[model samples]
Structure formats: C-alpha cells, structure tokens
Target: MPAPERIPPGRVSSVDLLAKGELTVRGRVREASNAVLYCSVSYEGEQAHCVYKPVAGERPLWDFPDGTLAQREVAAYELSEATGWGLVPPTVLRDGPYGQGMVQLWIEADPSESLLALVEDEEPGEGWKAVGFAEVGEGRTALLVHADDVRLRRLAVLDAVINNGDRKGGHLLPTADGNLYAIDHGVTFNVDDKLRTLLWGWAGEPLPADASRTLTELAATLTEGAPLATRLAELLTSAEVEALRGRVGVLLGAGVHPLPSGEWPAIPWPPV
Candidate 1:
C-alpha cells in the first residue's frame, strides 16, 4: 500500500481535502465490482478516509458509455446536494493515484443500525416496508424488508430522479450520529429507465409533502441556465440531463411514488 504524503498543519474542508490532498491508496475494497480504493488523503495536515474509483478501472457496460461512470457518480452527488438532503457524502472528481476519478468521503456505518431485515412473516410489520421475497438458501425464502424510515424515503426519491440502476442495501450507510448516507452511484443517470432498487416499499404510494416540495424546487433548479443544470451538463449528456428533468417533472405531476415499469428487472441482483 502507498503512504499518504506529509503536509504542513492547516485546516481545510473535507471536499478540499479530497480534491487537493495527496491521495494514498491504503487498500482495496475487495468486494466491490470496480476498483474501489480505500485511500487516505492529506492536505495542510488535515486528513480523511475516502473511496476513489479511477475512471480507468471502470468496466465497460453495454448500456453506458465508456469511462463515464465516475462522472455519473459525481453527478449523483451534485443532485443529492441540490435536493438539500445531504444524502450523499461529500464527493468530487479529481486526479488520483491511477488517474482522474470520483473521490468521496468515506462514512463508517453503525453496526447496530437495523435498516434492512429478512422476516418470516408475509407482512413487514409496523415501521417497516416490504421489498419482496428472496431466496435465503436451501430452497427456503424470506421476506426482504427495509425500514419505513424518512431518510430512506428521501433516498428513494433521489434514486428515482437520478434513474439509479443500482440501489442495493449494502449501499446504505447509517452513521452513529443517526445520519444516513447512500453510496455506490456509478451505475446511475442512464438515458434509459434503469431505476432498480430495494426501496420499492413506497412504490405507488402518495409522495410525502417534503418530497413533493423538494421535487418542485428541483424542477426549477434544472432549468436550462440554472446552476444545477449547468453543472449536470458538464457531467452528463444533454439528453440525459433532459431525461433527468423529465423524471422530476413526472414525479411532480404524479404526486405519488412511481411504480416499477416492468420493462426490466425492478430490483438489483443480490439485494444486499
């Protein structure tokens, strides 16, 4: 593993640290599909852990253009910020050990947080929402469910807007401070309908007041010359940006959570 470079003592923000600091690869997240590097960044004596996904390491997907996943991940962060939801950790696009990539602040998940679970009963019970049934092993199946959490609900809305292709349970991070952050958004923002996720609990339900309001504000922010629209233009194609705006408009018009279109698999493989 490479070591972080030494720097003088000074204070800088997390985003600045990730962007300007010396990035040293501490290890690899072996379970990740892409080259997810666990790295330490230091600038002016400020340090933080982050996940770096170099564009070169991204595997070519038939649906998405080559070398665009990193930018898509950054785009997801931008949309999350625009929603004022703070659902995504601080993220930036910058050069790293391998090359330019998406660098995002790492968040430690609280082990005790019970956000998702498998239940034997048909119903998800109070305070929980059913995703569907899943095969556990040995021909037995269990009900997969997630918390009817306000935070997770907001994330579902964000996922819908981003056309997130993958929103597995493992991507959710619940910190000790009770903050929930979602990660691994590289498979997002496709021009096609790819909003696969485990957050279908609220599907077809009426949109929450806060979510409706956020979508309304987001629609205005996505206007041609708006700041959010301008930033997205840099990361995504014009058609993709237009699709995003269209999704938001559809959500606003529906006034309810969207149901899966059934054109493709509604949930990701390996739900966790």
Candidate 2:
C-alpha cells in the first residue's frame, strides 16, 4: 500500500478544538461510527466544525491497514471535489503515535430535525436541500422534498453507479444554506460484493430526466479518460467499473427496480 497522506497537525488552530465528547450520546453530526471527536476548526480562515477520528486503539469493522483506509478516504474526497459534487472534499489524512485517522470538515447537526425534516424544510436561495427517501414501516417515505424530484433521482442514479453500500440517513448532510452533502465513503469502490444500501427502494422507477443526463455526463467523462476516472481506476478494477456501468443500465432499463426480500447486514436496524 502507498504511504498515507500527511496533513499538518495544529494547522487548524486551538480555538477550533471545541470539545471531545461521546458523539452518539451528544447527538452530534457524525459521518461514520468508527470514531468521533467534535471540535471547531478554521478551514481557509473560516470557522468550521470538524471531527477527528483517532487512529489509536480503535477498532474498525474491516481489517484493512489503518493507513490505507485513511489514504483511500482522502482519495475519495479528492474525487468528490473534482466531480464538483459539493458532497465531500479532500480532508487532512493524518497519522500519529495513536495510529492513523482523518480530519474532515464538520457539518452542523440539524437541531429540530429528523430524516423527515428535510422534506418539510423549504429551499433557501442558492442553497442545496438535502432530500432522500426514508424506509418507514416497510414503505418508502420522502424525507426531504425541497429539490426538484429530477435532481433527487439523478443523485440516486449516481449512488447506484458508485455502488454506495451505506447510504443511510446520517450520511446525508444539508447545510442551512441548502446544500446537500454525502459522506462516509470508506466502504465504497472496493473490489468486493458489498454494494448494499437503503436508497434503492425505488429501483424499478424510470430514471428522472436530470438523473439520466448526469449519468450520460459521467459516462462520457469516464470514456474520455477524465482524471477522476483515472483515480478510480487506480482504486477499482475494470470489472468494478463494468459493474457500475451495468448498474446504471439496470436503473435506466424499463420496469427495473431493487427488490428487497431478505435482510442485509449493512443496513442498520430501524433504518433512519
């Protein structure tokens, strides 16, 4: 494996280190469950909330080298940046005496929110509204419907192409200004059969026009050897790309949808 990317420690400044608390208990906005520490940090001189994943003495569900996962995460963020997804960005992947971890831009938690909150909130001027469907009592519920259904459908197609196996409610972050963000991609782009997630409840539905356009754009960019594709090729194999393409085709095909029959391990209980 390649050496983990190095980010300067203390680069964020002391004022940003707000508090170290139990994220789950405190109800902080967390992108992953592996490790959590809440803090305030300055990103580009702007006061930003941040989370630190301590590398030391923590356990991950997978057995990948701590260093490699951090590097892959950094790479994933870089890809997101290149795609102009605004979902995630390149973060500080770091290593210390404790082991290896990452420092990511923190998203504020919605105070009066639940997964259903997105649907109720109105779109703000020039802001992205984070909206998705939630599984409610064996049926699908629209969580946030601020954006046009077309845009949401396109994002769903993108998720399929990425084979994102963990598109849970917590992964969706909506800025008060209206921008929706997706995080926690460590489990994606792997050369394995782990493409499971909760967002595929509407599998057989026709691809919304916006989604078809986005997929066409992504496919064209990949065929033309976009830098993002070059990077993905490094992490994923030809077969993986083919599978992604196949998934896209399936989503676009007539009367095709994801059929949920058995319980999946990756899906959290009482999927939010």
Candidate 3:
C-alpha cells in the first residue's frame, strides 16, 4: 500500500472528508471479492486515503438482495458508531465516479500485531482463547486460537448484534495506536442467524460488563421510530431491521456470548 498524499493543514472530520471530497482512484485492492478501489479524497485541500466500493461493481450473492451490499456496509458503520466502540472506521454512502457506493477511512494495520494463531496444544495457554481445531494439511491438526483481549471480545458482541455472516481473520485490523477496527461488512445484518467467524473463542461465555451495558443502550436506540432505526430502515428491509432489534433483545436477555447455530457453517471457508 502506498502512503496517501499529505494534505495542507486542516481540521476536517474524516466523515466530512469522505462525504464531500473529490475522489481520485489511486489503485485497486484486487484481493477483495467486490470492487475495492483504493483512493484519496480531498476536501478544501484536506486529503486522506479511503476505500471506495461502488454499488455497480458488487457481485451477486444468492443469500443477500442484489445491489444492497453497499448500504449494508454503511449500516454496519452506523451500528458500530452507536456502540461507542468505533470498531468500524468512519464510513458513508455517497455518489462516486462509478455511482453510489460505500466509502470508508483507510487504516494502516500494524504488521507486528498478532491477533490470531494456530497452536499444536489441545488447549490455548494464557492470554489466548481457543476457537476450535483446524487441519494444517498433511493430516495434522492445530488449535485455532485468538487473543483474549477485551477489544476482540467487544467486537464479537458487535458481530452478534449485526448477524455478520463473514468475520474472517483478514477483517480484523489492529493499528499501532492501540486501536482495533473491523471491516468488510457487506454480508452483515441478515434476518437469519448467519454469524460465521473465527472469533468464536468466547462462545457461551458470560458477556462482559461493558458489553451488557452497551447492548442495553443499543436496544433503546433501535426501537421503532428512533433515529438509528430510521436510518437502518433506509439500508435494510423491514424484516431485517426488526430482526436486528430482536437480536439485541436476545443478547440482553441471554447475557452471554452466543454459540454457533448448527443450521449454518460455524466458520467461513478460508478462515484467514
């Protein structure tokens, strides 16, 4: 990834920069399933790097409605902001050169931060939580584990609330400033129970105190006619919005991390 061009001194907010700036296609992230254009957005000479995913470039998904992935991405960002966790970067839906799509602040992850690991031991040692077992080829198996850090725990709760269908290792972004952000939310907010991810280490565990409180607050904000509810209505179907509310209620009622539903695959293929 190339460094973003520096902007003259300014104080524009990231959301403002993304929503109003002129986008210049700097490059493309070819590894992404959907069209991911790496670009720089400049507003009044204040420039910053961002990712642009045009709705026209989205691929069809049998499970999700067509042309709605970009909206879902923005919806995920809204939910993340409502949680006060800021786990997802600043994202907005706006008209781009290719058409309307999702634009989000581009973050550079720290190369040295190790959040997931595979170990030969049956159980994970200190500072780690075991997810399950994975085949490492040659008929060998290893324990899939993730860090026991609170940041990841909070993200797990957020995932449950949104019913994220793909929480692969690549989506976890940890920066050098001690901030962790998650991305690629196009498959989230489905009405069905499709919470697939590698962060199942906390399954069946009691919800952390902070998480419980946040869920309680989120439930209130998601009630019918509320601001968040109204905003989500624009992005998701009525059924999906209702399901999101029900999910929060369920979390508050259950008071623990949810275990995977056998109805769907517990982990996404190519987990990393």
Question: Residue 73's C-alpha lDDT in candidate 3?
Answer: 94
- lDDT by residue for model 3 over 1-272, one digit each (tens)? 78665345668888889999999898999999999999989897788899999999999999999999999999999999999999999999999999999999998888899999999999999999999999999999999999999999999999999999999999999988899999999999999899999999999999999999999999999999999999999999999999999999999999999999999999998899
TM-score of 2: 0.60
What is the Cα-based TM-score of model 3?
0.97
Residues 195-219 of candidate 2: C-alpha lDDT, one tens digit per residue: 5655543555566565565555655
Instruction: Give the poorly placed runs of model 2, Cα more than 4 Å off.
Output: 1-32, 39-47, 54-68, 75-83, 89-100, 117-154, 233-266
Clashes of each: 0, 12, 0
* lDDT (Cα, 0-100) at 237 in candidate 2: 58
TM-score of each: 0.95, 0.60, 0.97
lDDT of 1 by residue, 1-272 (tens): 33333333566877788899899898999999899999998888678788899999999999999999999999999999999999999899999989999999888888899899999999989999999999989999999999999999999999999999999999999988899999999889888899999999999999999999999999999999999999999999999999998999999999999899999799998778
- Quick one: RMSD of model 3? 1.3
Candidate 1 Cα errors over 4 Å, as ranges: 1-11
Question: What residue runs in model 3 are displaced by over 4 Å at the alpha carbon?
Answer: 5-10
Ranking by lDDT: 3, 1, 2
Predicted model with the maximum TM-score: 3
Task: Provide C-alpha RMSD values for all models, in order.
Answer: 2.8, 9.1, 1.3
